[model samples]
Target chain A: MIGEWIRFGITCLLLIAALVGFTAAVIGAYRFGFVMNRLHAAGIGDTLGIFLVICAVSVSSGSFLEAAKAFLIIVFLWFTSPASSHFLSQIEYYTNPHLYRYVDRKIQDGPHSDEKEPE
Target chain B: MSVETAYDYLYTGALIWLSVLILFMLVRSIMGPRITDRLLAINMIGTLVISCIAVLSRLLDESYLIDAALIYAMISFVSVLILAMIYIPVRQTRGKFEKDARKEIRAERGIRGSVTESGSPEYKAGKEAEKPAYEKGNAGLDNGRDTQQDASLQEKGGSRT
Candidate 1:
């Protein structure tokens, strides 16, 4: 009975942590000034927040099948989040005519070229 | 209260908190200035909903809801991708039209016939200074061999950076 109580406590802690992450994400998304900044904020909920919530649910679920399914959601999101973020940023870059005014870009000589190296 | 009853209360509180967060994200999406802003808010909403569903799966002891959450994640990802794909080509063609108009203006002025090799070095330098650094790198890559199409393709790569 004690073991079950311990597990329950741990699950509660994880869920609380997840809740905090989502709350922070929402706050950040609202507070940030730029679209790129907002994307950074939203990413918190996409990766860490979802992962924690799923972990909490999986811990409460004693069945191996259910836990595995929960784990799969995290894995799938790990791949999808970056892809979506990339495409969204691409959309922003291409569509925004005055993007250069807001975003600073640094030009380097080549991929292998270092800042210290002289031309 | 019994431990199970306490757990139930905790779950209920979490659900209410997540629901509030979702509403906040919805407001952000509506008030956002750009398409990307709205898309990002929508993406976040999807994530919050997934978490809510996962919690519900545990709270209600319904295993099928987890599957529903998984499907929701997949659909959210695809929707973002699809929206991006739809927007990109339209932006590119609009850029092409502007380039053509600039060329026509130059032709009428008897300044230059071709898009390539026309601008003076000072003009080129000033234009390069105005452009974003990544665009300057892309312009450098636009050498004698490739045409405007290749240059535009290289510009697409600039967005990734």
Candidate 2:
């Protein structure tokens, strides 16, 4: 009975930590000035928040199969989240004409060099 | 309370909080300024929902819900990938069109300037203004110096008279 209570305590703590992570991500999404900055914030929730929640579930579920499946979810997300962030950043770079206003970029010798030409 | 009851209460409270967070993310996506911002919010919403599912799985003593969350993760990742793919080409083509239009306008402006030799004063002024004063080889400074010299010369001439 005491062991069960101990497990319950740990689960509750993990759940609270996950909730805090999600709350921070939400606040960051709202408060960040740029899309890239917001992406950084979202990454926090994607990684730490989900990890904690799954950890809690795995601890409380007490079944090897469920724990294994939870582990799979974590692995999948760990691999894919960075890829999605990269793609999102690429979209921001290609779409935003004013990206230089936000990020420092070296002007390469190409069509981009003609930006200062009077039109 | 029994461990079962305690677990039930904890999971229930967690699910409720997760739902609230998801609702907040939904509003963020709706209010997001850029396409990336909306996509980011959607991604976060997917993550929150996955956690909710994981919690629910434990609450209900079911393992299939974990599988459901896994599938949800895969789908969300693919959705972001596909949407980004769709948007990039469209943005690139639109950028190409704008660039072409700008090149045409520049060519036209060049032709007019060469043929007339005295192109529109406003256009000339705009072009001049596009360059910084320092890059103009200190022309304003030179003018100021010249005016000062002329003023001194006039004062000397007046004194001599």
Candidate 3:
């Protein structure tokens, strides 16, 4: 019974952490001024938030097949999230006419360029 | 309370919190100024929904919902890719139109000897605005050499405009 209680406590804590991650992601998405910054914020929920939630569920599940399935979801997301983010970033790079205003192009020329560092 | 009951309460609380987060993401999607912003929000929403479904699978003791969550993840990824494929060409045409307009203005200015007026703030700003697109186009060309997908898109964009 003591061991079961400990497991329950750990599961609840993990879920709470996931909830906090999702909350932060949502808030950051809304607060960030630039699309690139917003993408960075949304990525938190995509990777860490879901990973924590799935971990919590798997812990409570206590069955080999269920835990394996939960881990599979994490693996699948880890692979796909970067692909989707890359596509989205490409779309942003091509579509936004004002993108150069937000992003520094001088950085592209090489880190050792003659451009004066911003103070 | 019993361990089972405590677990139930925890799951319910998590579901409520995730639902609220989903709603917030929905608002972000609606308020996004750019198509990419909206698409990003939608992608995040899909992720949140998957987590919700996963939690629901255990909470409701319905093992099959896990399969549904897996399917949802696959569909979400494909949808984003398809949307991107459609969006790129439209943006390319729009960019071409803008570039043509800028060229016409530059030609008119050159005829008026405004090329010597590059010291003016407006001309300087316009040049600054043009630089990024030029750089991006060159970068796209470089990428085109590396990837057939980009090369094909460039070809289609060139043919359309």
TM-score versus the correct structure, for each prediction = 0.71, 0.71, 0.73
Q: Write the per-residue lDDT of candidate 3 for residues A18-76, one digit (tens) a residue.
A: 98888888888887766777788888666999899889989888898988888888999
Candidate achieving higher TM-score, 1 or 3: 3
Write down the worst ten-residue block by lDDT for model 1 chain A: A110-119
Candidate 3: clashing pairs of residues: none
Number of the top candidate by DockQ? 1
Give the Å shift of residue A112 in candidate 1.
28
For residues B1-161, write the lDDT of model 2, one tens digit per residue: 89999999999999999899899889989988788988888888888889999999999998999999999999999999998897777535555554554456447645655564333466456544533343243345443354345435645765786
Candidate 2's residue-wise lDDT over A1-119, tens digit each?
89999999999999999999989989988876667778998987679999999999999988888899999999999998888888888777677665642222222233333323121
| Cα shift from native, residue B156, model 3 (Å) | 41
Error of 2 at B78 (Å): 1.1
Q: Model 1: which docking level applies? A: acceptable
Off by over 4 Å in 3: A104-119, B90-161
Candidate 2 segments whose C-alpha is farther than 4 A from its true place = A104-119, B90-161
Off by over 4 Å in 1: A104-119, B90-161
Ranking by DockQ: 1, 3, 2
